[model samples]
Target: MRLRKGLRVCLFCLAAVTVLIMAVACSPSSEGDTTTAAPPTVKQPILEQDPPSGETGELETESGTESGNTEEETANGNDELETPAGNRNGSAGQLYALTFEDMMKMDEALNHEMNYIAVDLSEMTQLTEDDKTYIIEYLQGFGAEIRDRTLDQLVEEENPDQSSPSLKGVLLRVDKVEINEDSAQIEGSKYRSGTGAIGVKITLKLQKGAWKLSDSEMTWIS
Candidate 1:
């Protein structure tokens, strides 16, 4: 009976040790499984770089604004090109205003040229060749002075009938001037011999720094 009791005690001790070892092994596996199954812990915050809000909108707005400005500049440049080079200040009327001396010079030049044109004396059929030559030479020399004289003085000096030809030329009296960049319109009265004042419009062009008559028209004859 003592031997059996000792053997039973040894068996109990071995069973307890085996149970403890199994418990220890199962605890480790369970703990490992529990640890693995749980949600992961984040120590440092995860930061991902994202573009600033409205960045694309701001970029698009800036691009549109720049494009609009470029278009406006181009339009303005085209407008500038359309305007004439000399009219940038837009003071053409003032700049091209004629003076008294200029008018006198024009009158003198015109009378000189008209002297030749007036040589056709339609009513004076009895004039000899020598007489015609002498009269033309005399008129060419003193045409302006004689024309500048009063009509009464001219009538008394010539002492001819109404059929006799008068060498007096037309005198332009400028009333208005409209100047462009390189052209001008002169509105004037043209006083012709025997004919009363007539309205005339003369166009002038600038060439080589000088104003030259481009065209002329009689608007009205009174």
Candidate 2:
């Protein structure tokens, strides 16, 4: 009986050890089953740069002046007189025609010469405002001048007024006119007190349909 009991106890002990060993072998190994944590994700930063200095990056207007600037600059930059459409051709022929019209508007011939004398005096001497004003105000119109005596009766008169000449000669006459689109060239003859018949070459431009004097640098030769 004692031997049998000891055998049973030994058998039970062996079975428990075998079961423990099987459980440990059959279970998954911690080494192969373990999952590693993903590495922390990194974010990139963005950087911005400044623009260059003293560069406005704005365009200038057609008037040759900058917008949003001073009024003085704008006024100075603007051309006071604009060339007319027909006169913009810059042709000598066109200028001559326009100049003739301007000349025709002056006072008569003799009065025109006197007006020139007055203008010369104004330039040569520093006359008072009253004298200058009088000369400018009393000058003849564009086409005709005024004289004190009549040319027909002057020679027959007993004592002709020697101070004032009766005949009023044409001060200036428009001989020819040439126009080239924007420009005009005029050839005319001018009679002055000291200078006899003097030929004049005038250049004009078409500004707003009216002929005006062109810039000296932009003279039309042809």
Candidate 3:
């Protein structure tokens, strides 16, 4: 009996030890485990952008957009194209202007060459004082004498005999003007000394409401 009792005590103690071993085996093995646990994360902040422009022009942005309008100058030095101012003197005024312009070479007196001007308009029945003034002013700057008179009004001859022939100044005259609707012709003569004389033919046309010199030819040279 005592042996059986001793065996039963030993069995109970063995069972208790086996149960304790099973509990220990079932528990997680934490020995020599070096894996680290993850840390807590913090929330990130959001940024705000500026509002776009509300005006009718261009939008201010980081990328690209062509926005403004560019203005260009017109013919008359203004923003818009405009018709040229009218000349109340009509085609006659234009004729006179072109005739004088032909005489005015736009060069200094000494820098200009002797050439036939336009036809004489002193006898023009339609000529105005303003037209004559324009003719005189425009004919300046050229090396010539502006005469509105006829050949009879000037010295008919200069030093009949060639005695050290000197420059007696140039005298240009144009008369015998024939005007039509679209085209006109004139005869001009230039006389400097007894030997210096030339005959010129000036032709003009009415173009775009403006009288322009069509052609100028030296008919005779002496």
Candidate 4:
């Protein structure tokens, strides 16, 4: 009985050691089974850049749009400028006609006021041959012919009170003038002592940078 009791006690001790070893192996302490829960997942935040705002950004956008519009407008304007309605040649023709008309008017005024006015004949030296001849013919109609008259002769003829008063009163009065490239026509009335009114037409030719009377004729309507 004593030997059996001792054997039983040794068996009990061995069983306890085996149970402790099993518990330790199953508790995740074994090298092959030891795994720590993956370190608490740390989420990283994503960074994003935002667009610019406010008046400065708006101004930039507006400036770009305005620049584009200006370029387009400038292109359109250039197209219009490329063509002109009345070109240089047309304008020059009109100017020539206008110049001739002005010269005719000046000539008519000078002739109408011949007696009461003193014209500086030196100023006439620059006149075209056509203009000189027109003056001479006009003076001749007033009974004071100026054939081959120098500048001095014309001055003496036009001096106030030198010629007869009756003759001066019969001088031609210009009514209208019509000019063309080659010719100009002057219409006027001659006043005489008892003859009432006589219509006169003087035709002038453009020659040598001047206008000269080419023809002088008288016509009676009444």
Candidate 5:
């Protein structure tokens, strides 16, 4: 009976040790619940912001105004270069029918000789031999009838009072321009103190990029 009691005591001690080890392995830990870390969160970078309402409106208005100004400038530039359909005169691109303003300028150049050289020569021929010689030389420089006028006739034919049908004028005003291929007909009038008025036809030819006085005819004089 003493042996059996000792054996029971030994068996009871082994079972208690085994049970304690199992409880220690299976229980939840304080460190796992309170001190464990969580995963890190990602961050994004900031770039730009939208403009204020007033500033945005102002910018849009300025852009529109600039566009309008550019268009107006383009139109004005084109106006100068515009030509008639088919470029009827055959001289197209930047060279069109002469404007009235240009016609007036041409008339001025033509009449300059009539008022000064012609009248001056007519008066000079009567004064002296030297004056007559000078008048002849001067008239030679002119193109047509004035160049052919004899010295004696110059002295006798001078009619500054406009009683005779002669060209003596202070102004030449061009009123019409008729253009043909490489040529143009210009009609205008001459005005003088005593001569009253005269209608004249001038023909011009384009040669080497310039309008040259090809012919001139008097229609009527008063």
Candidate 6:
């Protein structure tokens, strides 16, 4: 009976040892120094990269001006609406015809030049030097210093009084010139005097291969 009791004790001890080993193996480890995990590091871009090929990087308005920009540059940028070069003498004549008409009202020519009409065509690029010469010739002998005057540089060295032989001249500067096959719209200003200046917008029509003034409006008078 003692031998059987001792055998039962040995079997029970062996089973208890096996159960304790399994529990220890399955449980989370706690042997090393405990440490808290850190989150992943994410880096961000400092500057955006350039756009791909054929894509526009920066945007600009139609009226945006660039370095060394000029009137010709601005006008030629609109390729679809660009006008043919050197095809506008009608509008040119229309701008100066009114002055000629007023001169015609006089019965006779003046003994000496009293008033001057100097046209500045630097802004009107559609006309060439030859075109300018033609206009000057057309307005010649009108009791004014028209033929002797220079259209490109309207300024005279001296601005003399009426009593002097030098005529009181006005610098005619055309700011904008728009022309089509059927019509033309022109904006210009007359530098008569500091206080006697005038700005004009003229609409002209092409009739019989000539530009005739359809209407003229004084935009500003000072």
Which clashing pairs does model 5 show?
A: none
The C-alpha lDDT values of all candidates are: 0.52, 0.45, 0.58, 0.49, 0.52, 0.58
Give stretches of model 6 more than 4 Å off: 1-113, 147-156, 159-167
lDDT per residue as tens, model 2, 35-152: 8645679987877865554333333243346444567666767645432222223233333334533543432243444323212221213334443333333344343442222223
What's the CA RMSD for each of the models? 18.5, 15.8, 9.9, 17.4, 15.6, 18.3
How many times do residue backbones clash in model 4? Answer: 9
Cα lDDT of model 3 by residue, 1-222, tens digit: 999999999999999999999987887655424376445798889889656555423445322232222122233355244323234334565576665555343222512354423334556778676666666555554545555644443333444455544234555566568889888897776555445656677889887777788987667766
Between the candidate structures 3 and 4, which one is better when assessed by lDDT?
3
Ranking 2 against 4 by lDDT, winner: 4
Candidate 3, position 127, lDDT:
62
- Candidate 6 residue lDDT tens string, 72-170: 676678765653333444555444554333333322232223366666655556655656666666555555666334433333446443332332565
As a whole number from 0 to 100, the lDDT of residue 13 in candidate 6 is 99
Off by over 4 Å in 2: 1-167, 192-195, 215-222
Clashes of each: 0, 38, 3, 9, 0, 0
Residue 45 in model 6: lDDT: 72
Off by over 4 Å in 3: 1-90, 100-122, 141-147, 156-167
Comparing 1 and 2 on lDDT, the stronger one: 1
TM-score-wise, the better of 4 and 5 is 5
What TM-score fits each model? 0.29, 0.27, 0.44, 0.26, 0.28, 0.44
User: Candidate 2 local accuracy as lDDT?
Assistant: 0.45
Better by TM-score, candidate 5 or 1: 1
Q: After superposition, how far is residue 182 of candidate 6 from its true place, in Å?
A: 0.3
- Stretch of 10 with least lDDT, candidate 6: 103-112
lDDT tens digits, residue span 101-219, model 1 = 13333434344444322222333344444443443333434444323333344445554576543534544345676878798886655444554445666777777665566776667
